[model samples]
Structure formats: C-alpha cells, structure tokens
Target: MSEITPDLVRHLGVLARIQLSDAEVERLTGQLDVIVDNIAKVSRVATPEVPATSHPIAMSNVFRPDVVGDMLTSEQVLQNAPDAADGRFRVTAILGEEQ
Candidate 1:
C-alpha cells in the first residue's frame, strides 16, 4: 500500500500555499512515496548499535604554544588611516545612520 495519495498531496499543497494542478498533484504523490520509502529503509538500517558520525574518519585539533610578539602602538597604526578621530578610525555614515 502507498502512503502518499493525491488527496494528501493536495492537502500539503494547500498547507504550503501552493497552487498545484491535478497533473502536478498526481506526479508529486508518486515522488513523495518514493522519498518516504527511502527514508524508511535508511531508518531501518540505522540501528542503536551503530554510532552516528559527521565524518568517515576521526579528527583532532592541533595547537601551538602562545608567545608574545612585537606590536605597533595606537599612534603608529593610526598613521595609515585616511581619517581618524578619538583614537580610532573614522568612516562616513552609511544609509543616513549615525552612532
């Protein structure tokens, strides 16, 4: 027995606010049945004994030790700015918005 029917497809179209013709309804009924059957088959194969995974292989994060480095002062960084104000870079207002 098929789980998807024309009436069910019509109801789904109505819920989704879609205007489906009779031909479309009939076509979708068969297509949706195949999709639902595939999902059921996959579900039956996914037993609790098998673990779920996002990837086929295990993964680990690599990290390096943090070290202090030479840095530029605020005044030295601001020297390259086209516009600066209040110790920060200033940009023109966008879309008539101001902060």
Candidate 2:
C-alpha cells in the first residue's frame, strides 16, 4: 500500500500554489492515506474476470426516434405575432444595441 506522508502533502500544496500550515498538512496526510488504502482494496477486488462498467446498473437511451412531421408555414406562424415586418417578428431594441 502507498503511504501518504506530511512531506508529500506539503510538496503537493507547493505544486498547487496553496499555503498549508503544519496542522493542515498533518490532517490531510491521514485523510489521503485512508483514501489511497480504500482504492487499493478496490483494485484487488476488480479482477480480469469482472467487466469494467461506468455504472452499477445497465443504462440505455430512453428517447423516442426523431421523425419529421407536418410543420406550419412562416406566414402561418407570424399571423399570431403582435408585430411583424419584412416576413419576420419585429420587437423593440434591447440593451441599446444597433439594428
């Protein structure tokens, strides 16, 4: 098993440009050691016989197939607009932007 020491934590902090006190370095060392040990345990159990998977359960796409259907014409759609011009909907200028 790999060991996570305070010196290693301090070196990581330096690489990450983070300033960690002695107390923080000591605390992180213990936490990282636990994490590393747990990963090692998982590695031992995940053998060649067991297939690798991203999720615990099977997953698949649940969406319906895309199929083109009847669509309204541009004039038909613009008929309901409060204001339209040049075959398009016209709205007031926003954010002081030029047309």
Candidate 3:
C-alpha cells in the first residue's frame, strides 16, 4: 500500500499550483490514503478470467436500423408553407436580396 504523507501532499499541492495550508495538507493526507487503500483492495479482487469492461454488465447498441422509407412530395410538403414558388417553399431574403 502507498503512504500518503504530509510531505507528499505538500509536493502535490506545489505541482498542482495550488496553495494548501498545514492543516489542509494533514487532512488530505488521510483522505488520499483511504482512496489509495480502496484501489489496492480492488486490484486484489480482479482476476485474469474476468474480461475487462468499462461497465459492470455487457452493453450493445439499442438503436433502430437506419433505413430510408417513402418521402413527402414537393406539393404535399409546400402545402403548409406560408409562401411557395417554383415547387418549393419561399422565404424572405436574409442577405438583403430583393425578391
């Protein structure tokens, strides 16, 4: 198991460019020690027989297949538009072009 000493915590604070007081350093040392010990316990339980995975159980894509179906005709599509021209929906020019 790795030891989380006050000195190690102070060094990490310097590397991270954060200012930590003596009290904070002492407090963090105990917390980091617990985290390291917990990770060590997990490593001991892991076995070669178990396949490594990001999740606890098997996962797969649950999405439906992408397939093209019947499409809307130009007249049917333009029926709901406020304006239509040349078998297409017409809108005001955004770039100041006179129509």
The lDDT for every candidate, in the order shown, is 0.94, 0.94, 0.91
C-alpha RMSD between model 1 and the true structure: 3.3
Which model, 1 or 2, shows the larger TM-score?
Answer: 1
Clashes per model (N, Cα, C within 3 A): 0, 0, 0
Candidate 3 residue-wise lDDT at 68: 100
lDDT of 3 by residue, 1-99 (tens): 558999999999999998999999989999999999998888987889867789888899999999999999998899999999999889977875564
Report the Cα lDDT for candidate 2: 0.94
Error of 1 at 49 (Å): 1.3
Pairs with backbone N, CA or C atoms under 3 Å apart (clashes), candidate 3: none
What are the clashing pairs of model 1?
none
Candidate 1 TM-score, C-alpha based: 0.70
Question: Tens digits of per-residue lDDT for model 2 on 3-99?
Answer: 9989999999999999999999999999999999999999999999999999998999999999999999999999999999999999987865554
lDDT of 1: 0.94
- The CA lDDT at 63 in model 3 is 100
